[model samples]
Target: MLYKKKYSSWLHRINPALKLVLLMGGIIAVLFIHNVNVMIPLVAALAGMLLIGSGQPIGRVLLFMLPFLFVFVSTGSSMILFGKGETLWWQWGPAVISRESFYRGVHIGLRALSFGLIGLLFALTTRPVLLFYSLMQQFRLPPRYAYGFMASLRLLPLILEEFKTLQKAYKVRGVDSVKGWKGWWQKLRLYAIPLLAQSIRRAQRIAVAMEARRFNKSIQRTYYYRPGFSSEDGLMVICWVGIFAGAWIVGVQWPLFEITDVRFNE
Candidate 1:
């Protein structure tokens, strides 16, 4: 469900490890930004990148972000309704709406939106297999865990299929359906035992296969996919730096919203 069919996006060319590091830095930087004016431009930059980098149409990308938008609204609205401020716009028993709170709410919303854009940018660009493989190659990650994780991802579909088959079998065999919590517990026991047994058997088989194939953590080995940095990496770095630089310049100079520091009202 999460997989993207297209691999031609420019973002795919960037090294996963480098891309991840840069992305983490960007997210951390975003957390420090408290100004709505700053966050607005930043979010715009991210949205632009998403549209351009993902090679997706504006409509499609916006459609993808609908859920995140809902999250932004919920979080921002909560802050606006409940946040404390001296300048009151509306008052209720527990809820208070003020100019400061509204600004803060917008700031929070923009932050959330920026996060969604960043996450989607990474997801849309990075392939799961490539990500794991890149981690193993670039970071010298212990092969035991890497290959195990890859194997598990590959087996997930089969495991799910088996679970469904087992469920159907239980129904065919006239398993009694109890009511309420007991039914839930009974279902758990009935389904869990067989699946656990199968999973253990599968694990044992995989272990044997790996040992037979001489897979181990020791000794250097060549990789089928070698993730390396390129001009594109530099370009990505420049773009990231450019976005923040532009955001800070525009936000400070123009000053879109009233509140500058969202952490505290001044």
Candidate 2:
């Protein structure tokens, strides 16, 4: 299962549709509100949500965040160094630092962190099958499209297993002469051809089976599992909206972190 089924947290019980909405909404809000002060708190709230939803230890969560943190800081630093603004804090050759640029960089970094946390929260809490079911049932997604997408996600582990089996077979045959980047590319080509063939065969078989079952004969279909909205989903939506509104208000109140249109003015 993609989601941890062992936890009975409120987040785990919320509807997958609502979780998706929250994820998209948070990202959209972050994109519009470019202020570190506001984004920092939003990031913290998302982290807290993830912790509560996943019921994972802080260390584990932080470990998962390390990679995202690296990406966030690297991109933010680039923006700080290269972004244009007035009131230069420092200048050396091709590098320049300005107060507005620094703030913008921090804003972007916090936005990255916030987005990561929100995305992780959804991924860690919601099962892929549940998401597909929710989309089809709640959002009126076409069953063919939803099932196709879900099948792709379910195929990922099978593909990995097939790759591993191929590697073991190669080892048993004593054909393990590949090394380095070029060798890796060669190995990838070898693997890709077989994998593609296998995938095509599997897809053909699936299509035949689905056709035999008359899956495409009708646009309407019955679902074995139907996800429904609950009171918890409503509460979660309210909380998400309130938090976003509060963050925006706080951002507007903080004059130091306000977004300045330096490029247009100067």
Candidate 3:
């Protein structure tokens, strides 16, 4: 559902090259800012951009965020539980946890969330074909590789459909009840044989079609669509710069969200 809506929409109005630049700038800004309060503004800005650019519902946004939140929370908590620190908040003999460690974990989790949200905003709004063209034109990426990337993206849906049909056929042929870890391994190997064969066959057909069209011998090509930077792109760059500046000033000057430790002997 999300995939269909994303492609059929008018989000292609935004320039793919500009979007790549903005994502790079945002990532650089994220590297310096550690405080949740500082990060909140950045996330909010990206949220507004995604909402306006993609016209996706809040429900969709929340659904997209769910998996990333789970990943960060699980990984971050484990790190805190095993970390060593002086201000022990929880302890079971040598197995100790501290406030410092807990807060560090929280920081890591929120940072991950912020990065994930920003990236998702970009992915949801930008068409993969446009992204490929932008890379080829603006980033000077090799055209052959760009075309290959686009082909892979285009093939994914069809490939998944084929796999689904293959799975159904396998189930009907008395290959049922693959339940646990060992079952998963058995299923993968069983599926792998047919999948690999189908993939090779598909590749051969595609190569032949490309070769018949003289695809490789062509040095110059024409694009149906050309991407251009707009005023909105400038605004986005400025916003990213401002966030980094504010974060640096606030963090260095007043310490708005400081986490530090003091040692003592009693």
Candidate 2 lDDT tens digits, 122-162: 77778888888899888988777777777667677888899
Alpha-carbon runs more than 4 Å astray in model 1: 176-193
TM-score of each: 0.90, 0.88, 0.81
Per-residue lDDT of model 1, residues 155-205, tens digit only? 878889999998799889998799999999998898888888998899889
Q: What would the per-residue lDDT of candidate 3 be over residues 1-266, giving only the tens digit for each residue? A: 23334442344456787777877777876776656555545565555655665567767777887898797898678657776566788887666687667766766676787788778877777777778788877787776677766776667787789889988888899787568998989988877878878877887798778767765543677766677777776766676577566655654566534563211123
Candidate lDDT values, in order:
0.84, 0.77, 0.68
Task: Tell me the alpha-carbon RMSD of every candidate.
Answer: 2.3, 2.5, 3.9
TM-score ranking, high to low: 1, 2, 3
| lDDT, candidate 3, at 265 | 24
TM-score of model 3 vs. true structure: 0.81
